[model samples]
Target: MKSLLTAITTTVLLSACAHHDDVRPGNDNQHYVVIKSVDRSEGIKEALGQATHYCEQSQSNMVVLNETIDYKGELPEHDYLKTRATAEFVTEAGSWLWIIGDGHVDDVAAVAAVAGAGKLHSMGAPYFVTVNFRCT
Candidate 1:
């Protein structure tokens, strides 16, 4: 039973892991790497490890140049669509819905709630981080 659980867990973890891109040389003696992982910090850590290895191979030290983190996972199904619809309604209806009437205000309130929910839920999505480093 333990072995079966372990196997299933390993398979799920492997499937969740994103394909790692090899470190490549960029302009001006800098190196670039892109890594995606189930967790954000893990992706950044992996990039640092690759950069460290690269610098070690050249008998130099690693210096981080720049980095950008991005989200690579889709929001839960219709979450995106729901957010868009809410935003569109507000843009089309304008503030009059909230200033004069209370019914549209409820609709806007629901829209706000749904939009915020999507954002919160998306916080757990997969992370993609790009790191730039120089061997000095």
Candidate 2:
């Protein structure tokens, strides 16, 4: 009986831990970005607030990051746009977005790095932008 209880407790704990991963401040479904440094960037809270406002106004929650972001896989178009918009707004608002994932380029820094560096790499999807913005 004791062993059974222990097993159940462990299972419950593991499940809870997994659930908590999603609750992390930057790991949620929000778009991830990787700003180059922390020196001149606004923190996440201010960016999140503005993002929430933009989302509320646009009826679309496009969460963005100010830096490079890597994700496990390719994000869908709508999700990407929403995340990108959020990232752009926050970056413009003086916040920096850092990457929260590790598989693919999902953050602005990464995109900017690639685009600026003139590297031709694709993560199974074509990302094309006619206009580009440079940040100091």
Candidate 3:
């Protein structure tokens, strides 16, 4: 009886392994763009716009968002940045991309690495985009 149980267990384990092998791999490296926000203003808008323009070169791109934020009315010292401009994205490579138009901003590094891949271009102060990516 113990021998029969061992045989059944081995067969089940092998079957599970075979099933796992059947699972196909995915092309996670598929390129896409996260628009985040599209503004025509000098701040955040310009930076985001440049990213949008640059991302257009990619055939398989995804626009993250197409909206604008107004931070003028909010208090500068307050945590208005948390709500005013926010974006989240993922890439196969370990990096962050960030684009901003407002000179008054925080967490620029995290944003740039995830979005810009550390390649940042400034249209002006507070108007810049940083790229982060990896080809898989």
Top-TM-score structure, candidate number: 1
Report the lDDT tens digits of candidate 1 across residue range 1-136.
9999999999999855533345888788888888766456777888888888777777999999898888655765356456545655554454444455577676785565566555545545356788899999
Please give me the total number of clashing residue pairs in predicted model 3: 24
lDDT of each residue in 42-92, candidate 3, tens digit only: 444443444444444444342433334433332352433332243222221
lDDT of each: 0.70, 0.39, 0.36
When sorted by lDDT, best at the front, the candidate numbers are: 1, 2, 3
Per-candidate TM vs. native? Answer: 0.48, 0.20, 0.20
Instruction: Indicate the worst ten consecutive residues by lDDT in candidate 2.
Output: 127-136
lDDT for model 2, on a 0 to 1 scale? Answer: 0.39
Angstrom error at residue 42, model 3: 1.5
- CA shift of 74, model 1, Å: 0.8
| Candidate 2 local lDDT, residue 48 | 41
Q: Determine the C-alpha RMSD for candidate 2 after optimal superposition of all C-alphas.
A: 19.2
Error in Å for residue 95 of model 1: 53
Tens-digit lDDT track for model 2 on 33-74?
A: 222111123323433444444344436645444432223335
TM-score of 2: 0.20
